[model samples]
Target: MISKIELLNEIGIALSAEKNSQKVLELILDGAKKLTNADGGSLYTLNDKDELVFEIVSTDSLDIHMGGTTGQSIDFPPLPLHIEGHDNLSMVVTSAVLNDNTINIHDAYHADGFDFSGTRKFDENTGYRTKSLLTIPMKNHKADIIGVLQLINSTSIDTGVVVDFSSEDQKLAESLASQAAVALTNKKLIDEQKALFEAFIKLIATAIDEKSPYTGGHCKRLPELTMMIADACDKDDAGALKDFKMTEKDRYELMIAGWLHDCGKVTTPEYVIDKSTKLETIYDRINTVNARFEVLKRDAKISMLEKQMTARETADEQAFKDAERDYEALIEKLNDDKEFISVANVGGEYMAEDKQERVREIAKYKIDDCEEERCNFFNEDEIQNLTIAKGTLTNEERQVINNHIVVTIKMLDQLPFPKHLENVPEYAGGHHERMDGKGYPKGLTRDQMSWPARMMGIADIFEALTARDRPYKDGKKLSVCLDILGKMRLDNHIDPEIFDVFVREKVYMEYASEFLTPDQIDEVDHSKIPGFSGD
Candidate 1:
C-alpha cells in the first residue's frame, strides 16, 4: 500500500544520508526490488577496465544474498563492455547502459534481441523461473552512466504470481536509480578527496621526518600513540575520563592534529636540532681545546730543555731538578684540564657550579704562538657552550627549537579547514602546553585544553622520552621513562587521568614491543611510580 512518489522520495533521502559506498549500493538495489515488486535484484558498477562488475545481488525466493552489507564478496567475473573492439550489447544490463534506455521485458524466456543463456542457466540451477526483467541505467549528475540496476521476476502483491513490471513500476525504478546514482557519485567524490588529503598530510610529515634523521620516527609514531591512548580513554567507563568519547569525525580530527603537532619543526634549523654536544656548532670545539693542550705540552718541553742548557753551564743540579719537576707539574695540569673539557663537551643533565667556574677560569689562559690566532684555551663561544647548565642547546637555540610549535599553529590556522576539523590548530598547538599553564605559545591549563589535545601532550612526551633514534641522548628504558612520566603527572605537567589510562591499558608496553629495542623494554613497577595506581 506504499505510494510510489512517497517511496521514491524516502529512498532519495535514505540514499543521500548514507556515506558508505557499499551500503548505498545495497540500499539502492533493495529499494528498487521493493518498488517494482520484484523477487530479486542485482547492482553493477563500471570498473577501471570498463567492465560491469557485480557489486551486490539479492534473491528473496532463493534466500540468496552476497556482496555489500552481507559481508560476502561477489566472485563473478566482470561483464565486458566490448568484445574484440565491438560493443558487447548482447547483455541486457550493458545494452541499457550503452543505449541510455530502460529495458523492460515481459518475460526473459520470451525476450528477443538479447542473450538470456546465463539467466536460463541460473534459473535451471536454482529451480526458479526467470521472468519480467526491468533494467535501468544509473546516470550521475554529469549525465554519465556509472552503474546499472537490474530487477528480475516481478510478482503480484496478493497472489504471489509472476507478472510484468507495470509502467508505473518502471517510472519509480528509474527515479530511484537516479537518486541512488547521485548519492553514490557524491560519496565516491568525498571518499576520493579524503584519501588524497590524508596522503598529502602524511607526505608533509615524511618531509619533516626526513629533515632530521634523529626525529624521523617521531613524526610517524606520535599520532599512533595519540590514537592508542585516546581509544583507551573512549573505552574506559570507570575512570575520571569515563564521560570522554569520540566519533569517527572526532578521531580523524585528532589524528590529523597529532601528525601536525610538530609540523613547525620543519622551520627549525638542522644544526640546532642535531647539536649533540655543548661545544658543537659546525663541529665540536673540544678538538680545538685538545690542540691547545698539545701546544702547552710543547712549550713545557722547550722551557725544560732551555733550563737544562742554563743549568749545565752553571753546574746547578738542584735547579735542573727543580725545572724538571715544574715541567712535569705543568704537563699534569694540562692533562687534567683537557680531560675536564672533554667530559664537559659531552653534555649532561647538570653542570656543577665549580665546573662552570672552572670553564671561565680556563678561558683566561691564552694559547701563545699557535699556527692560528692566539686564542684562549677555550674561546668565548666555547666557554659559553661548556658552561651550559643542562643539555646541549643554549638559551637562544632552545628558543629557536620552541618556536616550531608557534609556527605550526600559524601554519595550521591559515588553512581553510571545515567545521569538523576547525580545532586541528588548537589541538596540535596545545600538545606542548602543560596542565599547570606553564607550557608555551598559549600556556593553556588542563581545563582550558580539550581531552584529545591533552592526550596528544602525553603522546608527544612519551615518544620523545623513549625514542631510540635521537642524536643527543640514548632512548631511556621503559621503567625509566615511565618513572619520569609518572613524576610529571604528579608535578601537573601532564593529565593525571590520561596518564592513569595509559598505564592501566599498558599502551606504553604495546608501543615498546613494536618500536623499541629489546633492551629498552624492561619490567615496570606501577605501584612504585608517583601519581599512579594499579587500577
Candidate 2:
C-alpha cells in the first residue's frame, strides 16, 4: 500500500512534466487504472458545447484500446452535460462533472438513481458483467470541471475477483485527476500563446511584403524555401549533414526565424526597394532626361533652319548643300545619343566602361533650363546612377539596402523571447553572413554559425535568384538560378554542405513546381552545376 502511494507520487510528477496533451491524458487514465487495480477505464474531456467527449479508453480484459496515441478513434457519441436545458444526472461521467465529486459504485446492476442502461447494453453485447465503477471530476486551478476520469471493474489483487473501489483508491484517482487537470490546462495555455505569437510574426512579415508592390510575396516564399533546405539537411544520414537533426521545437524556432528574416526590410525605403530604373524616385526621372533630349533635338532643328535661311540669302549651292548635310548629321548624332541614354537608364547585369564614358559625354551637353540658366543635360546624381556598372543601385543605395540586416538584428534583439526561442535573433540575423567571413552585419564564418541559419542563407539567395516579382529583372530559369547558387557554393559565399543537400534532395525543383512558372522551370544538367559533385 505504501508502494502504491509512492507510485502515485511519481505519476503526479510525470503529469506535471509532460508537454503533450494526448500523452498526459493517456498517463492519467493509465495511472488511475493501475492505482485502483481496475481492468478498464475511459477518460472524457468537456468540449465547448458542454459535452463529455471520450479522449482515452482502455479495457485490458476485453483487449480494447482507443484514442490518446493508440491511433484508434473512439466512435461513441459524446454525453451531454445538460438535457432539455437541465443538469444531466443520469450518466455517471456527466453526473461526476455536474456534482463536481467522485461517484463510487460497487455494482451497476444494483446502483440506484442513475442510468446504467448503456453499460448493461454494452455488457450484454460483449458478453461481460458490469461492476465496480469509480468516476472522478477533473478540476483545474480555477475549480472548474474540465473533464472526468472514469474507472471500471476494480479487481482484488489476491483472487482477481471484481470488487468495489476502496476509499483509498478513490482518493488516489482524485489526486491524479487534479494533477492531470493542471498539466492539461498549462499545456493549452502555452499552445494558445504560441499560436498568437506565430500569428503576430506572420502579420509583421505580411505587412513588410505589402509595403512595396515589387516585394510581392518575398516574406511568404522565403520561409518555405528555408524549411525545404532545413528538412533536406535533417533527412541526410550518409554525408556531411548526417548528424544534422531537428526536434519539433527546433523546427518551430527555425520556421519563426525564417518568417522574420526580412522583417528589417520594413525600415527600408519603398523607392529604393522599388527602384526599377537608374533614374527613378517618386516617379521615373528618365522622363525628365527624355524631355532634355527632346529640347536638344528641337534646338538642332532650329539651328538647321537658321543655317538654311543664311544659305538661301547667299544664293550659294555649295553652302546650301553643306548646311543640309551638317543638319542631318547633327540630328542623327543627337538621336543616337538619346537612344544610348535611354538604354543606360534601364539598368542591366553589367555596363561597359565605354558606355559609362558615353554617359559622361552626354552629361557635358548643355541645355537651357526653366531658370534661363545653362545646365548639364544629365545632373551629377543622374550621371553617377547611369554609370553604375551593375544593377540599378549605386554604392550608397546598396549600403542602404544592406542596412536591413543590421536593422533586423536590432529589431529582433529588442524582443524578450522565451528560452526555447532565444536563438531566433541569431538565426534571423545570420542569414546574410557568409561562410568565408566576408558577409555583412556581423561577418560570421561557417564554423561560427548554426546549420539552420546557413540553410536560411542559401534559401535567401536562391529565392532572390528565382523570384518572378522583383521590379528590376525577370526570374531566371532553374538551370540559371542553380548555376549561380552553385557558384556561390564554390565562392564560399554560402554553406557548401547545405547547397549540396539542396541539390541532392531536389529541394529547388520541389519549390519550383509550386511557386515558379512552367517557362522558368527549365531542364538542369547536374554535371554543369558548379561545386556539386553528386549525380
Give the Cα RMSD of candidate 2.
2.5
Candidate 2, which ten residues in sequence have the lowest lDDT sum? 315-324
lDDT of each: 0.90, 0.91
Off by over 4 Å in 2: 315-339
**Shift in Å, residue 349, candidate 2:** 2.5
Candidate 2 residue-wise lDDT, 410-457, digit = tens: 999999989989999999999999999999998889999998899999
lDDT of 2: 0.91
Q: Residue-wise lDDT of candidate 1 within 84-184, one digit each (tens)?
A: 99998999998998889999999888888899999899989999898889999999999999999999989998999989999989989998988888898
Q: Which residue pairs overlap in candidate 1's backbone?
A: none
lDDT of 2 at 503: 92
Q: What TM-score would each prediction reach against the true structure?
A: 0.93, 0.92
**Candidate 1, which segments miss by more than 4 Å at Cα?**
316-336, 369-374
